[model samples]
Target: MSLGGETAKATIAKFAMAAVGFFGSILFARELGPKAFGGYYLLFSVTKLADRPLMGWATASKKQFADNETKRRELVGAQFLFNAVWILIATAIGLLLADRFRSYSGIAMAPFLFVVLLVSESNYEAFDRVLTASGRVGLSTWTDALRSYLTLPLQVFFVFVLTGYAADGMVYGLVGATVFTFPVIFYYIGTRPAVPSVDTFFSLAQYARYSIPTDFFATLYNRLDVILLGMLLLPAAAANYEIAAQLTAPATFVATLAGSGLMPRVSRLRAEGKTVGQEVTNTIAFSSIFAVPIFFGALAIPRALVVTVYGPEYTLGVSLLAGIADTVYFRRRQRH
Candidate 1:
């Protein structure tokens, strides 16, 4: 497929995934109610917050893979080691403080869930970066789509249909979805080799010099509000903020798909003595096709969109949604 076609495919798949997430969010909100669901959202958000550094490693891995296909295994192995260390350390800490964390977030099975979440998230993030860098854009998007769409059905079965606990249900569903999608990822990347050498680790870590701070700030910027609202305000407030964020996810996903497709092509173009500046220009133009409409639409009908999609209690976040769209717009415009 052409780049435009690929972008559209990824974007449409992401929109479908977002719809699945939207539905799941509604179920979570309605079934658990705002307070409990807020606590659960906070728990998950904090887990993602902690994983930012590891996620930076994954982002760096993408760039490294794009830059040098020969180093794919070494890059994958190094990141595997990075995530393994993080998983072990985080699990230990979460186990020791599980009760305290659970009390604060009202998330059940906190320690066990954290371990599972970290493992699943690490695998998914690593898989995504590798897929995108390898130029398997379709597969990359599909893996993410599988996780997003499959989790909702599994959660529904466990959370409401089978009368299981909502938090456990969501966590289990996430694990299951990631596991279900793992074989394709594993097939693509193959197994991690033996533990890489110290030199290999450092080389991989070097790439993260750029990714680390960027990922950290981006993760914190995205989640700090949710975290603060959960901690300092009501859980319902946190839930509302999450709803607003989710509402803006498509625009962000568009930029992500474009960037993911762009980098490898950019690297390849440069190698072929082609003008990468033109490619970057083309990508921004393509992404803006979606970004511009979404931004203006959000500004025009934020309340209608929020209320119609997420129900009335969330209408208070319409302004937040508009602000998020503005952020999305500026970020896309400034992206290289």
Candidate 2:
């Protein structure tokens, strides 16, 4: 497929993921109720934060795979090694601070759950980025789509059938979905593991220098509010905030697709010694057309939307939805 076709496929997949996630959020809220859903949201947010280091390596690996196809296997194996080691360190830290994490997050299982969910999510991300960067975007998209679409049903089974533990059930569903989708990533990574060398470490270090801090602050910027809300307020408040944040996902998903879809194209333009300013301009202008409607719609429709989708109790989050709606632009700007 051509670039436009690939991008359209990714964009469609992202939107489908968003739609599935939005419905899942509603089901979670309805089934778990506010307090339990809030705890689950906290679990989700913290795991998201825990993904930073893995995200950094994944971002670097994506660039390496896109830029150096011959080295892709080595790059993939080295990254796999790095993440395995990092997970061990994180596991030790979680064990040592298990009690503290329980006290802080108010979830007795926070430390254990965090480690399990983080490892699963981190591995999924590492593989996803490599596939995307390697131009197997359709495969990558389907992997993500499977995970996204499966979460709701899996959570229903776990939460309602197997366990009454709402938050834990959700975490279980997430981990399972990720694991179920791994074979696709594994197949694309191919048959052999590339042995890591001093050169592999050096390359990873060079890219990490640029990607780590970028990922760190980006994760914090996106997740800090929910973390703080969890700490400072009742679980209901955090759940409300989660609802608001999720409602803007259509906007967020579109913004992400715009960025990810255009990165290689932009990089290619740069490599060909072609001026990219016009390309950037065209990207921003095209994105703004869709972005404007989503942003303003979120701002204006939050109350009705919350009531319609999540019921009236969630209506309290209307302001929060409108406030963070502009984050779509922030997501877009970072791609530049």
Candidate 3:
């Protein structure tokens, strides 16, 4: 547990993931353009919300079985069962709401596509919590980040070369990428420690109860503005808002990586009778030092980047990017 080793690995994963996400965003934005990009963003947001039940079960299972192998396995099984129920329930709601709001701005998916997409996405992602609880954030972060990067070439080719379908191509690329990596992920899961059992599920009731609001609040914090923009502004304006906000996603990813890496070390230090106040201070000081400059720089160059990088049509809301950049700063500050 050399601090230097942990620090190096975490830094590499953080910057590498952001770099990949950055280039991928450019490719994706170009492929999607404004209109189709907006639709893709909206659909992804909705599907993300639909994933909370799976997330809740995962979080509960991970926490409950953090130290127990048999319990962990049972918890995983229950997580799948519970997630299935929610997927079914959400499918029914999607059928009704989609028919009623076929022309809606933010959510224009087919009757059951929302549930189907989220279920597929979440089922794989849910294991992430388990990995994290097992102190495998190192593995989780690097694996997922690498997976995202691996998906980008195909996404670029499929969206631009084979099909000019924009958002559809983007979604297909995602599903296609996940499909390709399924075996690798499952193999990794198998190699990791397992705690297979049924009773672990029943012991997790309390943790599941607490996970609901945490998941909802976290989702809303990240996405409430998108929902609000769709309702309050014109569709075009809302699309602009989404692009602006999404540009800060890399910043969010960086902060998450930093915080995740630091927290466990800080916790261990505190347990070993060291005061965490200095660590907290150092974390904030260093984060702000690196983060502030990048944010301001991005704010200054939003329009040029949006136009030359994404497309000319995306220049509709330069101010919004700067605004969202500040949002990321404040968000990091508050969390830190």
Q: Who wins the lDDT comparison? A: 1
| lDDT of all predictions | 0.78, 0.77, 0.65
Q: Which stretches of candidate 2 lie over 4 Å from their true place?
A: 272-279, 326-336
Q: Rank the candidates by TM-score, best first.
A: 2, 1, 3
* lDDT score, candidate 1: 0.78
Q: What would you estimate as the lDDT of candidate 3?
A: 0.65
Q: Candidate 3 deviates by what RMSD? A: 3.5
TM-score winner between candidates 2 and 3 = 2
Question: What's the TM-score of each model vs. the native?
Answer: 0.89, 0.91, 0.83
- Clashes per prediction? 0, 0, 5
lDDT of 1 by residue, 44-99 (tens): 88788778788888887777777776667777778778888888888888888888
State in Å the error of residue 165, model 2: 2.0
Whole-model lDDT for model 2 versus the true structure? 0.77
lDDT comparison, 2 vs 3, better candidate:
2
